[model samples]
Target chain A: MSLYRPPRTQSSEITPREVYLSRRSFMAGTAAGLAFAASGTALAAPLAATPSAYKVADKLTPKQDVTTYNNFYEFGVNKSDPAANSGDFKPTPWAIEVGGLVAKPQVIDLEKIMTEIPMEERVYRMRCVETWSMVIPWIGFPLSALLDRVEPLGSAKYVAFETVVRPAEMPGQSGFFQPLNWPYVEGLRLDEARHPLTILATGLYGETLPNQNGAPIRLVVPWKYGFKGVKSIVKITLTEKEPPTTWKNSGPSEYGFYANVNPAVDHPRWSQATERRIGEGDGLFGGRRVDTLPFNGYADEVAGLYAGMDLKKFY
Target chain B: MALPALPARLKPASVWALYALGLMPGLYAFYLGIYGGLGADPVREFEHLLGTWALRFLCAGLVITPIRDLLSVNLIAYRRALGLIAFYYVLAHFTVYLTLDRGLILTSILGDILKRPYIMLGMVGLLILIPLALTSNRWSIRRLGSRWNSLHKLAYPLLLAALLHYVLSLKSITLEPAIYIAVVTVLLGYRLVRPKLMERRRARRVTATR
Candidate 1:
């Protein structure tokens, strides 16, 4: 036989490195597909921050509208479940502990947290990882305001939050195998922590925080999946390393620590490029899908943070 | 002494044909819901309609064996198809509750399960059906044999679970679930007492003839 090599593969053409990289990308793409399958709904419209800048609004959302929505599981499964079960959680006498690598570590009560920070009303679109989204006029102050009080040490690189845990009160906590720990935990990179979109939210639609909606205090990271914004906070820790997060601990590949709500990145099991907005009623887009936004369309404010990084690899 | 098999058309397609037609009403209800259909409470209407279909199909599936045995007709072929159809509607019923009603929230669903006995029973009913659905095939039939019969016997417990789920889910213990419970108990009791009664009757007839 003649010493002829395969035409498609030259001695230098399909290198092993190229094959490895392609395989890695394929695996990553599959993982994104899985994530999308787990959660995919309509992309929500971003609500504008009102000029009035009131600490609270008359009605953040209509009463009928409030009952027709949601996807927070720690609070419960039904859209109206959190609205009902959340009422049982006591928000009074709630305290926020600030410590760990912080120069000015101190504990602040709920009243002080609001007084120390100026509350602005922002109507931001809340998109769940599972794809359904809603536009809510949230009443809260920027996270930067709270960090200012903590005064992190030079070594502090990440900020961690812990949700209040009361298994007796929160029946969901009865099962030990709950993917998340008794209290929900979430974290942010130091720079991401300082972003303006990061709000330490208190109320929605111009009223006191509803129990189902993370009443006493919660984080609102507009660019990330809803879970990144932990609810019912009891502790805040500044650490040299990234903190353990609920989703990441449960399934690392499915829920990255960043958990940025990027439509471009497929979530392993489903496509993230589009979503279905629930309860809008039918017509052109009624019960239909809509295109997803990059960084949930807050790219103008948060895109620069990941400028030099390769998202596909980091994702 | 037996006649040769008749052609497909001559063999009664009446029951099968009627069952096939029953699917249209559900599809129509779903279609109506889809196209500006159920007015104010579309979600609730859809839920009610689908839940009804689940129960109806379940009762229909249960009745197949009794009718077949009493009439000495071939319903074994229809049983698999009917049982699967029952599963399909029930799956749809559960899905609407999860995605539409529950919004797919894990923490919240877990909470409801803990607080509501009705929700817990409904979930148990749903979970018990999983294996039956998995094994409802000829391949499994041949492979499993007597074990298959034993496993498929779970339909009795499943039906009870379903009735309990339904009764608990209702705001009041109305005439509907009570009727279903009565009917299903009689059916299961029939299955249990059937063979012994037939044996005693056969013995009495032989003694009388002698």
Candidate 2:
């Protein structure tokens, strides 16, 4: 077995667990369960995660809003469509297939994998390509943990992720005119994939992931736009050549493979200079437009990953 | 394939009622938006609803002439109200955009207008409608006479601008947006062949009378 261990954030440098993990019992108790019960939707088991160093000063987007407003196109295209239409999605009995250019390619059962790796609660700021942002408390381990397990070969330069294509379960895929190509795919440079900030999220808000929010497993890259965090991933492959990403294929001019949250790079239809912080204010003025940050304010940590390369060109 | 004619005495009341009815959707959407029926990002949803209603009214306005020409349905009397209602929705949509969406951020709004083709098209459509809305009165119509019809022909270009604005607002040409583009294109395309169709109808009537 490979013994290359990734660095861990020191307890002194890390944000105190108590400071970030407030209202724990309440979140684990009634709030989410009551909402789902009232809506007549089944809730997943509560997840226990060690609070990680990764965090933001911003208030978390309300759990209700976070769970309800989703963009899992496997469910549908509209923001609300996912929550309403994901009733049929089955996340249990899932297994992720890791193969291609890896020293040991094997299928790992979801529960077994979760138990093996140490998961953490990372409060990350998620900026969507639509110019909306949410501060989410995600429960997952660093992707590097999984990468180390698979043991990438020297030839592996990029990591490609693929969401499962279950037309029977995912209505969006079965539709005559699909918004995106099936088996929705995304990729990252090997270095970016292994970045400490990158994670494979299994839960949020002290609970297992709601089906609308990618269910059993998903990726979370804080520096990049939300779309880059591919959901309900079933397969991961390492390749020498850069893999084509879904959004890049769908709209080449508008979406780049390196979908980093760069405010300077304006989208063709809208500006990226600012973003609406979802559920920010009270009542009607709930969403406030705030200036977007380069690399979504993670430049301090991850900017060195692209030191010499021009982000504008690569983006 | 024939529409019932409004009684001559009731026409005025019906016309006023039509004007009021035309505004119901905008009012309902506004009410829903205020009450939080529009979802988490209500401001954007409300703005989108207003803009979408503006487009629907524009489409309804364009459909009037075509219905009169092809289907022999005389909706000509409501044309002014349709155009005026559309202008009102456009005004509402623009107000929401400036005050709510952009939060009166002049620099950001101006930058968006300058850079975004979608915003530019919407702005141009608004500009074109201003003069039309100003002249859509009895006094201006009497004074301008034949010139009014020529001026009001700005509807064609206004429709084009609004359609492009609507289409461009979407991330890509998805089914819904594509359908909207197709329907509106057909409506505008019908306007070109309308004259010939009317001329043929006139000739046919003359021959039948003889």
Q: What's the TM-score of each model vs. the native?
A: 0.57, 0.92
Tens-place lDDT per residue, model 1, A1-315, is 111112322323323334644544565478664553232110111222333232221112332354335545565544555654554577787899999989999998888666656677765666677665655667788888889888988999999999888866665566543434557888999899988778888876545566666767889987787778788889999999999998788667767888877876766543456565544655211343455677776777688999998776555
lDDT of 1 at A262: 83
lDDT of 2 by residue, B1-210 (tens): 778887899888988998889889888877877777777788888788778878888888889888877788988888888889999989999998898889998988999999999999999999999999999899999999999999999998998999899888877676778778887889888888888888999999999999
lDDT of 1: 0.68
Query: Deviation in angstroms for A250 in model 1?
Result: 1.1
Can you list each candidate's DockQ? 0.05, 0.54
- The residue pairs in collision within model 2 are none
What is the DockQ score of candidate 2, to 2 decimals?
0.54
Q: What range of 10 consecutive residues in model 1 chain B has the weakest lDDT sum?
A: B168-177
Can you tell me which runs of candidate 1 are displaced by over 4 Å? Answer: A1-68, A175-179, A282-285, B1-210
Q: Comparing only chain A of model 1 with the true chain A, what is the TM-score?
A: 0.77
